[model samples]
Target: MSTAVKHDDFQLPVMSGYAKESYDLCKAHKLSFQRCAKCKTFRQPPRPLCNKCHSFETEWAPVKGTGKLYAWTIPMNPIGKAWVSYMPYVAAIVELDEGPRMATWVTDVPHDQLKLNMPVKVWYDDLTSEVTVAKFKPA
Candidate 1:
């Protein structure tokens, strides 16, 4: 994976334990999420336990990187100065083929053209040398 192409002064996502792991995998161009080792359930916003089976054991599982656009929104104002250039970006909820819904951004399509249940695939945007964020694009 390559570092994200820098545009302006956009701030990168903060890295924590599981989030660091996720970002590291994305740096390698892999799209992974936390999965319960016992019951095999996938989850995002990676946590310490499985919500479904209440299991403590978990693993980082790579996903197919394909999914459907469940929903989306285009905020009228940018959050801050760094995001000013990219105002009105499409933020979306994508339901992965494996059943987990992730919060991501929809790219490569105009906001007006976005549709519910539209096919999409995971794409990486390297925000810095050490961070890569996962986004979705029309498949």
Candidate 2:
């Protein structure tokens, strides 16, 4: 048996390991990705080894915080209780100028006005005392 939390209780990702490092950077308002030192390729969802060169050496490199909206969707149905209030929000895939694409929220614009390949910029939301999420907005 389980109990449900309030709808206002937002669910956040668990910050640990490689993911924690990424969020830590975002907490500082710096949108960065794990870049392979050998090949200079940037990657999202920070990982231990490079998929291209299998290199273990990586650096947290900041991006220009600009990207294009590759795709998006408005979820009319909440995925969870925490998202009930955020229904109809834009869930988007942003392709960064640096080559890697990230899943993020695109806010501050009407749902009907969103266009494919529209310019977007990164923004940080301080969700909690220790967590900050990186989102996007029209640029």
Candidate 3:
């Protein structure tokens, strides 16, 4: 069998491990991450150093919650039938203003009409009792 992304479980990709700091920032109401103090370039999936310049110095900065639709797809069959309650959903790659791309669901709009390169802004969906994930919609 091909090792392609055939399962629904593979659809929802989030920053884990090295990127935990990214998730933490959203929870704190401050979008932050280690930007190479030397290069001043923003780093995603936060790390002790930079990906381009390999500089170890970094800090947190605010992000504007706005981005463009980098790429996306609509899942015909969402995770579970129950998820169909929130059916006709859209999964997208939103390139945040900070230059890092994040995966999210596009809400408050019809699924079929989702457009490419459309402008969008972040909105948190607090489905979990503890944490809220970022979703996007037309700006």
Query: Among these predicted structures, which one has the highest TM-score?
Result: 2
Candidate 3 lDDT, tens digit per residue, 1-139? 1011223433242647645566666666565555778888887656787888988888776678888888887766866754554545677888887787777777766656668888898776544333446777889
lDDT of 1: 0.82
Question: Local error of candidate 2 at 127, Å?
Answer: 0.7
Ten consecutive residues with minimal summed lDDT in candidate 2? 1-10
For model 1, the run of ten residues with the poorest summed lDDT: 1-10
> Which residue pairs show backbone clashes in model 2?
none
Estimate the TM-score of every prediction.
Answer: 0.89, 0.89, 0.73
Q: How many clashing pairs per prediction, in order?
A: 1, 0, 0
**Candidate 3, position 122, lDDT:** 78
Model 2, C-alpha of 55: deviation from truth (Å): 1.2
The residue ranges of model 3 lying beyond 4 angstroms of the native Cα positions read 1-18, 80-82
Any runs in candidate 2 off by more than 4 Å, and if so which?
Answer: 1-8
lDDT (CA) for every model shown?
A: 0.82, 0.82, 0.67
